[model samples]
Target: MRSYRAQGPLPGFYHYYPGVPAVVGVRVEERVNFCPAVWNTGLSADPPLFGVSISPKRFTHGLLLKARRFSASFHPFGQKDLVHWLGSHSGREVDKGQAPHFLGHTGVPILEGAYAAYELELLEVHTFGDHDLFVGRVVAVWEEEGLLDEKGRPKPGLALLYYGKGLYGRPAEETFAP
Candidate 1:
């Protein structure tokens, strides 16, 4: 067996861990919203579980506590600019709907023209340190039909990936390999 070493936490490891392809949007109550989160991940396949981590300091955290629902929208390469835009701004300062949005299956606002999306209902939340881990069950999923190939798989051209603080990159070609 080969020896491996675990490095100490870096200043921005969170940004470098393969950025998720979905824009996580949630409505807490009334008009309060949160800056979109990128720390999302797939947790299970059997029951179709997913989750995103929200720091306690974030406005989305309190929203998640009360509303318990959110929508994750996947954007194609064409919407990288919007992804960066949403990631850069905080919802506490502006009504996200004023930006550019569409009504999704769940009636929550989704970034208009997203490649695909899923509306989820929060099932449980786990608090860890400064962040809360929210696990959710997907209630509905929709995507643009033409984007898929003859085999019914998403054909990739450009997609957004994030790396620590203000850095964004496209996924490597092989990154989408089946």
Candidate 2:
């Protein structure tokens, strides 16, 4: 096994760690909910599986489990206000779908400015320590035209990347050349 430098575990260490930020949206009946998530990734290519790790204490957790499906938004950048608003409140108390947010083709709510979105069907749920890992199969996807270039690959610019301690940033504009 390869070994790497170790940083002592600390809360919000993710604030200094670079990672993509994602917003997960789901609706239960007439109520819609949203949450900011960074603990997610594409798990497979053949079956098109993805996974998100959420703490059980979050209201969005129950919603996702009950709904068995959800829409996820991956933003390119510049929506800090909405991200802060959604992350600061609980869905039970606030209706995040009230304005600006809309439902997708799969009936799941999604936020505007999300350059890429995916509607997923829940496949499995497993408890791992303090968080539950949810695996989903992609059923549908919607991406903004600009996100992918003419050849069909992601273009790098203004994509939102987060560091755990309430900080966010975008990739630098071509600081290097081939």
Candidate 3:
């Protein structure tokens, strides 16, 4: 067997590949923006909390702070191209208002083709290193019919998975339960 190690800070350290991609939607009045993010996850179950780590430099960062709410949408693997396109562009330069989206109960934009979406109300912001964690309490949720089983597990659907850099992947077609 062979192994490799790094002692100092690793640049472009995306060793944690294949993360579920989430399109974070934010709106400030008439302006709307969606940022593709992989650094997001469910934080709590009782209070139903979700968090997304975003760099302050991103345009959506300021909008999210001002609006005090946002929506997280998960598109299927077939929409991987759209996900990448949204992430590559910035709201400051490009106007994504024309994108196909509908406002959630909290007024945050939800992608039209998203299989699942969550409307969140901002609860707290924790700064860690280069990014700030925007923690939000899940206020409303929308899920496509027949996507999840009784246990809330996906039923043979391909989820968008990011592999860092400019790559994407999908899970295998096999499922196991014990």
Candidate 4:
């Protein structure tokens, strides 16, 4: 096993990964809700799986515990402001459902204007140190009609990437080079 420590110049720190666009939605009783999440990834192709990490303290976390179904919506670059608004605010104090949202297959609320969205059923839950890892099976997926390119592939707009220290970012034009 490899040992790890958080001290010294080469401390055991994970470099920041580029943020991917995602919106995590869950239903708590009759209320369907969702929040913007940056920590989401595709787990597998065979089982068609995906996963998102949610802090235990988030309102969506409680909702996820109650409802086994959720949706992950990907916003286009144009929706960056909306994603930021949703991420910065708390669901407990705001009613996101009141905003523009559409009902997906699982009855989960999905923002209608997103670039694309996927409905998922919870397959398993793993408790991590400060967040819960939600593994889900993709049940359905759809994309905006005009958002696809000539090859019928999704042409996603700019993505809103997250930086750890309360800062969000978009792609930098000339920062990194191959």
Candidate 5:
């Protein structure tokens, strides 16, 4: 492969995050909204904080900022189509809850297909370049019952890993390695 210097603000740079799980961002305001996000990760364990990077231009950003509470659904295998659909559309245009999504106890929309999810109350919104990083304290966490092993560590191969340019898949595993 040939090498070239990276340029400014290129979407191609996002492709570097291969195998990052797709995440669904949910917020409720005048209308409930769900947006697919790959730019999210956990920040703390003791305080149970999670951070999601979102552009101010996104419809969900305003709702998240206004409500100061949001939920995140981590996509598992077989749910990429829904993630793609959510990422492609703006919540300002349509009701995403019309799809097969349910509300958590906090009334945040939770996709039925989530492998793991967290309901969080906003702690901070800090600016970073073009996007704002939302930090929240996880108030609740949900997971598919069989997703964990006897020791509580997640078994490999069940996560939906996103590769940029609209592609997603699980990492290859040695079938015999287990």
Candidate 6:
């Protein structure tokens, strides 16, 4: 195999695709919005911190800054269309209230039928390049009944994985011990 040398600028940054897409929900006053976030991860174990990076131009960015709270909902692979729709559309244009969701412990909308959902209180906001990383402290979690095994791992459902460029896929159900 051959490798290429570095270039002045990168074409795109999604070589790291196939990550579980998160539907981030935020509400400031009565204005609630939902947006799909493919760039989210756990930041810390202690204090239970999580972070989702959002571009400043996105509507969710401002709402999150004001609300200072959000919910991250993870649906099954079967709901991939919903995930795509949320990402493709803008909250500034669409109502987004038609999506099936309910209020969480902190009053943030949590998507209904999610395999798992997390309610987080905003802890800090860090600016990195064009995106702002909204760091949050996990305050509550909702897990679907019977979805997790005794070890607290999700059973055999396919996870909704984003592959960038409007494509989506899922991991095989087969599991192995490392």
Best by TM-score: 6
Stretches of model 1 off by over 4 angstroms after superposition: 1-9, 14-16, 29-34, 150-153, 173-178
lDDT of each: 0.70, 0.82, 0.89, 0.77, 0.78, 0.88
Q: How good is model 2 by TM-score?
A: 0.87
Clashing pairs in 6: none
**Model 2 lDDT tens row, 1-178:** 7555656654334534677777988899998889988888899988999888889999999999999999878887678767867888888788887747778888988888887888899999999878898898999888888776665444676678777667777787674546
Superposed on all Cα atoms, model 4 deviates from the true structure by an RMSD in Å of: 4.5
Worst 10 residues of 1 by lDDT: 27-36
lDDT by residue (tens digit), candidate 1, 1-178? 6554656654445725657556777765455343556777878877878888888877667777777788777777667677777767777765665657766676666666666677788999998766788999988877777876666446655456666577767665564446
Candidate 6 lDDT tens digits, 94-177: 988788899998899998878889999999999997899999999999998676677755676557888888999887888888
Query: Could you tell which candidate, 3 or 4, scores higher by TM-score?
Result: 3
Candidate 5 lDDT tens digits, 6-59:
677764676467755535556555476787777888899998999888999999
Off by over 4 Å in 6: 5-9
Model 4 C-alpha lDDT per residue in residues 1-178, reported as the tens digit of each score: 7767756455422266557657887777678677877778999998899999899889988898788889998776677677777888888999876767877877887887776788999999998777788999999987776876665445533455666444666665443337
Lowest summed-lDDT stretch of 10 residues in model 5?
21-30
Clashing pairs in 2: 14-164, 15-163, 15-164, 15-165
The local distance difference test score of model 6 is 0.88
